[model samples]
Target: MIVEHRIYTTHPGQVHEYLALYEAEGLAIQKRILGRMVGYYRSEIGGLNQVIHLWAYADLAERDQRRAALLADEGFRHYVRKITPLLAGQESRILVPAPFFTPTWQD
Candidate 1:
């Protein structure tokens, strides 16, 4: 499996807005396109000013397809436009899961 992590840095004084927007708007759109959200977080320590979220994908191909579909979605486009003014910086990474990791809780 693949894990995609995105770390977003919000503009000063905009952290709450960023988090609120994600909760009220972004999460649902993301759930529709991305499937398997591992977590979403706001830093309380060294990564202050950051918002991190993770999603799992079957493979690179699937990830690419889903990302493309998400980018093409009109709602996502509107969402992006809505959040553009609040962003400071962004970073993303794709990681391979270790063999011990499993999608199901029983694993």
Candidate 2:
């Protein structure tokens, strides 16, 4: 499996607004299309106005297809429009588990 670590840094003081918007309008559409969401978090120390979201996919192909489907969704596009202004920076990392370690989701 592959894990995607998506980090979004919000313009100062906009983190709550961003998180609230995601919870109220973006979560469902994204979760439905993207599949497994390992976790969602807000940074309190190193980076103050940042949100980190973790997602798991079976492989690169699955990730690409799902992301493409998500991009095509009008609702998600609208949400993106809403959130874009609040973001200052963004980063994405694909994680491959080590040889001796693997992660799985029971559900």
Scored by TM-score, the top model is 2
lDDT tens digits by residue: candidate 1, 1-107: 88899999998778899989878887899999988788888888896788998888888998899999999999889889988889989999998867887767221
lDDT of 2 by residue, 1-107 (tens): 88999999999999999999999999999899999999999999997899999999989999999999999999999999999999999999999888887665824
Alpha-carbon error at 13 in model 2, in Å?
0.4
lDDT of 2: 0.94
Worst 10 residues of 1 by lDDT: 98-107
Quick one: best lDDT, which candidate? 2
Residue pairs with colliding backbones in model 1 are none
Q: Give the TM-scores of the predictions, in the order they appear.
A: 0.91, 0.96
Taking every candidate in turn, the Cα RMSD to the unseen true structure, in Å, is 1.9, 1.2
Which stretches in model 2 have alpha-carbon errors above 4 Å? Answer: none
